[model samples]
Target chain A: MKIYFPNFFQALLLIVLFTGGSAAFANEKSFIDEIKGADAPFDNRSVKLVRPVTLETVLAKEEYQGGAFRVLARKQHIERYKCSSCHVPGKPVLVQQGFELTHGDVVINHGRKGNELSCIDCHNQEDRDYLEDKKGRKIDFDHSYQLCGQCHFRQKRDWLGGAHGKRVTNWAGDRVVYNCASCHNPHSPRFEKRFPATYSVPLN
Target chain B: MGFTKKDKAEKIIEDVLEKPSSRRTFLKGASIAMAAGSAALATGCMPSGDDSSSGEMQLRWQEYFKKHYRLMTQKEKDETVDRLERLAKIQDDIDVQIGTEPPIENVLYGYAFNISRCEGFMECVTACVKENNLDRKTNTQYIRIFEMEPGKLDPSTGDGQFYHKVPVENKFYMGVQCFHCENAPCIKACPTKATWREPDGIVVVDYNWCIGCRYCQAACPYFGRRFNWGKGEVPKEELTTKQHYLGNRKRPMGKMEKCTFCIQRTRKGRLPACVDACPTGSRVFGNLLDPDSEIRYVLKHKKVFRMKENIGTQPKFWYFID
Candidate 1:
């Protein structure tokens, strides 16, 4: 009789666990739908035309070498991680089960009170493929500069004017510049302090 | 041997003078005879001291008699380029391209340095050295980055030889090169008109015409010139085969050289090597006539200052703080 009661309770628990998991998944889908329907202020089109005439465009037109603009897509760089492989399409939990994070090597020392900010703050919650702007707009990984420009408007203005950031490829040709993420890691935006190249010897 | 050769040459000149026709013809014939006698004597003495081949000798003579770069006709310039290519092939066994690319119209090059951003990387200095094909033996670097203390405007007090970790406490870096000043004292100092400012505001030196008097060097307040005391030691493998006639085509010993703002690259709408090499985006270069250029923007917005402004050299290069 004792063995029979425990066996009965185990069966009941299994049924409850399966049903609860499926119900939670259904709720998560509905939540994603609700978020998608919400109005986002910024779109890809608006983001692109924010600055009409950048310093790069001006220089590029003057030189006019039939150059094209290019940027590295985030998906290309972060494909190995496979965030969707472990993370389900729903709100993230404080602690995940059956998934051991091996990315401890990534150090985040950016922003005030760095530990308070998490990956989800800048990263999209519903979609792992793109980043999220303050207005909850889905930004492509290639256009992460737009995401960075939200809070760093002054820097963005200077960068647009050619006062900050580095220009890649030919300076006079088509203006293909490196994204902000190319030089500074989004998690840790500050440049690492290191020694520069060797000094030139002076004529004695 | 030298005394007998001189006597024979003199005797030939005397004979030519004695057989005088009209004044003009006699003088011309006499000069021609003297030249032939001297040429024969030189060939005779070749075995003793002259190791150069006859082809090389002819090339050297042509190079010596070549007109100034600015004055050379198109045909003369083409011939000179051919001669230089052949000389490079014969001497170094390397194929070299020497071209004369003129400056673009309505383009006066200007440079702006952001003092706040320069981290004393010295990348620009090395790039300038390699691109300009400067003499490594004499450490002929055209650019100097001065590490100066904050709250100080005196460049004389800055240390150019600091070999420590850069961005030192309370210090900023400022780089100086040939500013190509409008009121250039060096141009005024040249006795033979070997150096002059181009239409594009670049002060260029005709290597063949310079007499190496060092007058320009003395007159430059910014120490913007270098004298080649010995043959420039560029490794055969490291030789930049792409060269410009008045720019980096290997200069001979005893000629004064200064920066031409990378004429070979700039004339083709390409940034100078230093500008491309800078990692910090501290150096800005553009056409001063372009109202929308980065350099023009910096000039209009930033608090720009020029070195030695009191002296009124009117340098095209400007320094600014963002």
Candidate 2:
């Protein structure tokens, strides 16, 4: 009983193999592409469209909360004001001129040996993220501290524990907190001008 | 305030005495100044436009117009230097070292920071903007401090250290700034000699000379320099009238800028803005030349480190863990 496969059966088997191979090849190529230019694309990483959309949907903002529209507004704000006209703006926190962050001596350890963060790595966005309020209304980026706590659980815990950044006591109660930029300059995060030696002069 | 020949001589003598040279040299300069002052007075007719209410009629020096120092037109450069000397209350007859002075050249200064002990108070940022006379309209902030976790390299993962309500706990704030390098890539990247390293290892940018190419911004390994997208927002009423020549001079449109370690203040025996602003005394600054300085002491005794030492910029600034 040597069963000869009909021409149709043979054709169907070929189509199945061809379609499966192509799909597998396509998937492999996508993965390969990701690995090949991974580091290079870091400089040109576009905002994740889906993630922001998802974020807006989850927050259910009456106004679009994805922050996609805010990028140009922020750029315009920077332009109109000329933030770098007097001092350098867009400088990373770690490398602004004439800045230092250590005292007399004795190094403090905060665990930056293997995995340290860059200014953009955390700041990620060029503009501020809009947050959701209790009434499902979109708030300004000024109130986006809660958005930061989403990923920085430890720092958030420390913040809650009274140890990380600024300490703004709520006028209403101790339960409320102010956002990060309240004290920190979001652009150049490091090398602050306010230090003990500069107390005589009024600071920015 | 019109000065006669006698008044001119007296002013010259006073200037010579104020310089750092020896008493003999000072006396010689004084004699020359007196002679020149007398000559101008003898010529008669004080160069009009005397604003007596403003004070003595100060002769604006011609030193700023020297052809070799910069690219300004004959008229522009002359006016600039004249304004400078007048601002400094110098008589035109006095031979100021403005252009004739030898350049200090590069002394190779840079900064290194210890990332562990900083409390993200932002005292430094505020201090710098004020001391440098940064334009407010632009919100020109020079420093960026990241609240980072232990053993982590990415600042993005850290909550910008902003998670702390006002002053948070546990996380260490790491402050980074221009590592004024011995061989600054920013300087090399500039098409003009607008930004250069000073003899004391500080890098300075000439706002007037800058073309706003922004190549230096791209070339800096530490991302130190910044560009002005618009005119800065400094209030006229709040401006610090007292300014240094290369330090915190009023800037113009479409130029690049950055921190200079408060050269005007620092060179005059004062602390940089950031060092003085740290409430925790987290930052310590001093002349590396002085062995007894607090900064030198820290460098010698503590385990100090520069950020990205592998880049080989040889920063003058140092950082230590608390």
Candidate achieving the largest DockQ:
1
lDDT of 2 by residue, A56-124 (tens): 112211121111111111222223243233334464433333134321232222226555444334332
Per-model C-alpha lDDT, please?
0.71, 0.49
CAPRI verdict (incorrect, acceptable, medium, high) for model 1: incorrect
Q: Mind giving the per-residue lDDT tens digits that candidate 1 earns over A1-204?
A: 988998999999999999988865554344224323333321212112212223222122112112234443445566345666766666463443423454555677767883555777788987776789989999777677778888888777666666666455333433455567766778787655556565656642
**DockQ of structure 1:** 0.10
Off by over 4 Å in 2: A1-204, B1-79, B84-114, B153-166
lDDT, candidate 1, B6-113, per-residue tens? 357546644653454487465556655655565666788678656345556556556655666766678899999999998888787889999887766556678888
Question: Which digits, one per residue and each the tens of the lDDT, describe model 2 over residues B1-322?
Answer: 1113325644564465345657646555666576557546644554555443123322321332122233345566556655654554432222222221122221122233545556676778777777776777666767767767777655455553242333344566777677677557888788866787655667888775678999999998776777876666566555554455566755667888787776665553345667656554456654343332234445554576766766756566666653
- CA-based DockQ, model 2: 0.02
RMSD of each: 28.5, 27.3
Model 2 chain B weakest lDDT span, ten residues long: B99-108
Off by over 4 Å in 1: A1-105, A113-117, A169-171, B1-52
Each model's total of backbone clashes: 0, 88
Query: Scored by Cα lDDT, where does model 2 land?
Result: 0.49
Q: Per-model i-RMS in Å?
A: 21.3, 23.4
